[model samples]
Target chain A: MASADNVGILGWGAYIPIYRISSDEIARVWGFDDKIPDSIWVEEKAVGAIDEDTVTMSWEASRYALMRSGIDPSEIGAVFVGTESKPYSVKPTATIVAEALGIPPKKLASDLEFACRAASEAIRISIGLVKSQIAKATLVIGADTAQGAPGDLLEFSASSGAAAYIIGNPNQAAAVIVASNSYITDTPDFWRRDGAPYPEHGEIFTGEPAYFHHIVNAVNGLFEEYGFTPKDFDYAVFHQPNGKFPLQVGAKLGFDREKILPGIVTPYVGNTYNGSALLGLAKVLDIAKEDEWILVAPFGSGAGADAYAIRVTDKIEEKRSLAPTVEELIKRKILISYGEYTKMRGKIRKYER
Target chain B: MFKDSVPKYWRLRDVVYRLKYIYCRDCGKSSFPPRSKCPYCGSSNIDHRYSKGNGVVEEYTVMYQSEARYQDYQPIVFGVIRLDEGFRIVAPIVDVDPNSVEEGMRVEATLRRVRVDGSTGLIQYGIKFRPSRR
Candidate 1:
């Protein structure tokens, strides 16, 4: 996982839609018990408005990343968007987001799909690009306006959000990538067929086998390959499908609960799919002190997991406030009832123009 | 008729997405929706430049009733923004309450889904003003 050349994160940004729907509201609409929210460990979830989707959210996040990087948009030689809820099935969301951010044409751009882990793969690819000098900096984004079947359990956690990262030279980075590894298998825990408005999950089947297996393997592999242990790291951020999962996984991996608390964001914002672990990393990056080590693992339900050993640099203290923090974005919210949530999420069909 | 056709939107994407405007070297003025000729000086000696997308709201109105596709965005606050770069553009104000909008509030541009041609059509994204976080 360690490379010859030094590559790291130059800047990072996150976007959570301002609209939110409480677990109680979702429970009421689905005729579920009041204890369901507590049991799931999700209090509320962010929702994209009728006028919002992956592309728009990606742009908002990338724009902030560029601001923090303080580099001209033309310097971005690659832009990759990882999303499940693309507004258009045929058109590439990456080009639209790159164009919106004013990145020039002399760059590589595309949308990657591996469910939630797509963005982590994008980051891995960008590391190669930067390390090889193919691109001075690459923009990697994880964004989704995730969908859940009407009245299904997935509705409680499927939410919308995005997080963007600028991967560049370690000298100018806020955090350097020490090591990384990936573990994947063809196990089908969740999936959405083509043209299906919402996704279908394997209910309880999503646990142990899909999420836990890949994440645990990936993290253990990184530790083995890099000769590092959980105790050596200052913090751990795991892909959070729900609030309880990250904590459970942390304890399973020999990490203290406090070590994972700073990065657990799903309890408040629900599961942002692709944005899940990346958003947690962004939140940790916002507050992590210089010289601290952070371990991150993101899982996607096809399924796969990517683990990284990130070391915060002195540049972090100076660059932390350059853009809106994850906490800032999470705190700025307006709650909506189940009726308004359904309307905004387009659960009820409307007139065709 | 496809008013927001793919080609039509694609052709003017720089203008719509990035607030690209024409700068008249002769008159030292700028105009948005980038025209071939500068409206101020009728000068063809124009160069394209992107706005920082920071501005002040000059005037605004709230539309409670919107077009068919825009029903979900009811009470959209439409505003005339005076950019610091010396150009004015009309855009929708979002992410805030219409009642809280003021005549001289600071605003910044953000890319958002402006419209979709239809269920299977292209999703149009463009700049919309929001209350500045700075």
Candidate 2:
């Protein structure tokens, strides 16, 4: 029965796999011509090895968040992991992560499933929990290991990564959660059938029906609901299944390309499903100035969106010195060949016996 | 064949090299591997101090032999020493015959190789204590 406005993001962390799969290599293997863009817009996509999954990635991201926030794990009242791919069909991945982090058992904990928008929803839920005084702090994690049907355009961009945020009251916060809005629809633009190995998406349909429509409506709805305009935001990050979508949507919303450029993590990391948009937002927060406004919109496959407006605080500038930024992470050298990508993504087996 | 668990360089140059450990000024508790604040007091007030690297032998053990890769050195002598600073550290002891090992003997820290990290290709140094010559 608590309001979400009372809760704010206290700390944020991100993780992109060390290995990179060049779009050029993808094009070469797929037999696409040299004229095709290396990444439809960016140059490469990050690929996690076979050993990593949503759970492992969330653990790493949360480690960074806990370290940066200096928040004791025992103080957290809730643990929420939002992902499309659960490590197990029935067991809650959140419980596993909570146990690994040594968080106390007497806490509110659950896994959220809403396609890519689940993480944003988790954030909203944490805000409400803090507002109602039911919980003093919550750790919201978004992660995914998105698999695309072989030879599809999605294969080139669907990769794995994760992001996490510690949300709590403003007095104990690092950034203020200014406002948020949700744009929902029952459009099934993309989906994976039961037991299907990969997701099936309506290519051109996904563009207008889900990505464009939902993002535009969400941004506009947040503006209408909060009485703010595009110019008021310093950065706008959308669920980037591919690099071009966020830029295309930003242009439609009257935002300058530069404003959204810093939040575009897909060019280097690919679509991390639930973590895509939030990863971009985390990067922006790394270099954002105090009081700077940031807008985030995450669109899911079945068709739903969550948009949030946040303002950076002095704590952000203070915490900036403690952790590595997206730029620093980007400078690490990790190269994977086309064959390795196939192996890492489980497209091919090494021991076909 | 058993693979060499440690690298040749680390085995040859055994120094327990770590970022210096710091102790809390308010609470004389020592921190291993070093930290900016004391975990006990949560105070950033701390100072770096070197371990005397000498201690009383708390326990001792002997390995009749090791895996094939390390077979050249048979009957290894390993021991744990309780340092004057109130911490227990484990290391291999050399110079004294393995059959002559005994507990409560005074020992001093000595440099020796620990292991090899395949990725970085560098020798890791560790502290091994030997009976004090004095």
Q: After superposition, how far is residue B43 of candidate 2 from its true place, in Å?
A: 29
TM-score of chain B of each: 0.95, 0.67
In candidate 1, which residue pairs clash?
none
Index of the highest-lDDT prediction? 1
Query: Alpha-carbon error at A8 in model 2, in Å?
Result: 1.4
Q: What stretches of model 2 exceed 4 Å from their correct place?
A: A1-6, A349-353, B1-134
Q: Write the per-residue lDDT of candidate 2 for residues A1-353, one digit (tens) a residue.
A: 11236457777888776678877788888887755554367577777654456766786687668867778888899999999887666778787677656578989888898888888889888878888888888999999988876678787888888999999878656778877788889988888876677888887899898889998898898888777888889998888988888999999999999999999888887889999998998899888988888888988877888888887787887776665576666655378888777766667633211
True contacts kept of 2: 0.00
Task: Write the residue-wise lDDT of candidate 1 on A264-304 in tens digits.
Answer: 89989989988999999999999999999999999999999
**Can you write out model 2's per-residue Cα lDDT over B1-134, one digit (the tens) per residue?**
22344554333321243224667889878765566898779888898765757678889898887754233234667898777776566777754668778999998754333432332343244456667643
Cα shift from native, residue B55, model 1 (Å): 1.5
In candidate 1, how many Å is residue A141 off? Answer: 0.5
lDDT, candidate 2, residue A75? 83
Binned by DockQ into CAPRI classes (incorrect, acceptable, medium, high), candidate 1 is medium
Q: How far in Å is the alpha carbon of A57 misplaced in model 2?
A: 0.5
